[model samples]
Target: MPVRKLLLGVLTLCYPVAIYFGLQHWSPRVMALALVALALLRALTSRQAGWRLLAVAAAVLAAIVAASNHALPLKLYPVLVNAAMLGLFGWSLRHPPSLVERLARLREPDLPPSGVAYTRRVTQAWCVFFVCNGTVAALTAVLASDRIWALYNGGIAYGLIGAMFAGEWLVRQRVMARGRHG
Candidate 1:
């Protein structure tokens, strides 16, 4: 990956933890300003429309945080991320060439029709996952304490995502092996 994207990805992954500790040391306005700066950095580095929109959303959220001086706005970044993922994956389902298929094609460029269908189903699964994850993220952001929010958004959420990826890898291995035999 490009350094900019890698850096942004790392920063994004660290966001919840940053918010958790930042709250103890920084004012909400400062936190909000940091979010706005991150958003601007993302916008500058990425040209994809979805990413640009995400940047705008982040900026809006930052504005809210700045105005309200509240931690909840800071906490909603994960929810926003999930919503964006859901939108991307769900839209690909309605359109042709599902996102997972596009990605799978990077390695299996000549993927068979069954592989195509399988990727579509995987994309659908991701949409479902995004919806459920986003819902939980929203709930944690609003109804839970900061520690709970941080724990879920920062740690537990990534663990669940890792589980999904590992499960998918196992299933994909079976499918690929079966394709060779059958």
Candidate 2:
């Protein structure tokens, strides 16, 4: 499991540059095949049934399209993923125990009212971030060059996410400290 996590981390870090150059140097068909294989392996190994099923279905659909010799726009992958994340987070907002609250509960099962409010706000922030990220991804796919698309999707997006995570942690720490004192 550690090895898998390490590999995924490395792959994610390298994905943008790799895909950008990959599209330039290799045929789309080859890239599509490789991506499908990786997706299938991930799906087969996934612990969640829903994710496994979704991944399998997506892989099968991509495979069928590949077999038919249609060039699956490589740019669409990240766009679709961002859009899905937006939907997931947005959907969670409408349901009780929003996504951030669930994650917060994992750390503090008996979360305070203040903590619950904080998590809900954080969840809403994340939902907004997803929507903007997905919009950028879609625009890049439609209007930008391949290199530009890859750079934004790969490097810029990850950088923004890391910054957001760090910012949230800092805020949460301050909130918790204030709550304890009060």
Candidate 3:
């Protein structure tokens, strides 16, 4: 499977897990420990050693925060993780068009017919997952009478998801236009 497809699948799974963890109000220790485990797994499997190392470092920091049980660190960790995710998505968006051309070059004539279709399906699934999860979070926040933190965190998650959707749309538009005009 292509890296893009794999990433989309992972993100789809992560989105729901994040929402579940948030809704459960999982203790910082539990959340941090889980994320650390995830990071370690990602690091071990990732092709990029540098990013893998960074993930390891993030895991360590999360472990420390969990151990300390500090409110400030707990509050900051979510924001930091969200920022990192946003940055990764943005970087993917900013890649040069030539990269796609290179992918086209690399394609084998005998490649399976399902490859492209499968990628599209995965990408679309991810879009739906983000939209639904984000909407649910936002609505729960708005409807709840108490828990200001829930409302605030939900709002942020919704905004980030919206941003990602908008970015994806822009990329699709650009790609379509290039296909038509090129």
Candidate 4:
């Protein structure tokens, strides 16, 4: 990957961890401004219009809320990220190619008919996962303590996503093998 892309990917991956630990001393306004700057810079550089625009808007909203009430934005960051992901996935489902289908096309341009169906189903699964995960994060923010919220959204959430990716890869391998044999 290009250095810029790699840096962005690393930053995105480390977001929850940074938020979880940084909240102890950093003001949410500062973090939110940083996020807004990054998001706007990314949007300016992005070739795609859809997600980059949404990300910019979300970041601006985060900054606005953070400026007014630091605690609120800190609590809502995970929820907003997951909710945005859910929206992106759900919206893709309504269009010609779901997100998974588009991604599958990247690797398997002429994916089999069954593979197409599998990708669609996988996309749906991800949509559901995001919805449920976002709900849990929201609840944790509202009903539980900050530490509990951080633990769930920052640590448990990533673990669940990793497990999901591993499980999906295993299943996809089995299915593709079966298709080859049958």
lDDT for 29 (candidate 2): 69
lDDT of 4 by residue, 57-83 (tens): 668667675768556565676787788
Candidate 2 global lDDT: 0.75
Which candidate do you rate higher for lDDT, 3 or 4? 4
Report the candidate with higher TM-score, 2 versus 3: 2
Deviation from native of the Cα of residue 9 in model 4, angstroms: 2.0
Question: How well does candidate 3 score on lDDT at residue 68?
Answer: 81
Question: CA RMSD for every model?
Answer: 1.0, 2.4, 9.3, 2.2
Candidates sorted on lDDT, descending? 1, 4, 2, 3
Best by lDDT: 1
Q: Per-model C-alpha lDDT, please?
A: 0.92, 0.75, 0.51, 0.79
Off by over 4 Å in 3: 2-27, 71-78, 85-182
Name the lDDT of candidate 4: 0.79
lDDT of 3 at 149: 39
**TM-score for predicted model 1 compared with the true structure:** 0.96
State candidate 2's TM-score: 0.85
Q: What's the lDDT for residue 59 in model 3? A: 73
Model 4 is weakest, by summed lDDT over 10 consecutive residues, at: 69-78
Q: Which is the winner by lDDT between candidate 1 and candidate 2?
A: 1
Model 2 clash pairs are: none
Q: Per-residue alpha-carbon lDDT of model 3 for 1-182, expressed as tens digits? A: 87854874475345333644553686666766656765666676678765576576667767786778643343333444444544443443355322222343375444343434433443444545444554444444345332443444545565666886687668656765775698
Tens digit of lDDT per residue, candidate 2, span 2-119? Answer: 7885775576456556767887777766677655765676675668665565466557646765675443455566666666677677778898788899998998999988888899
- In the range 1-182, model 1's lDDT, one tens digit per residue, is 89988998888888888888899899888988778888998899998999999999999999998888988888898999999999999999999799999999999899899999999999999999999999999999999988899999999999999999999999999998998999
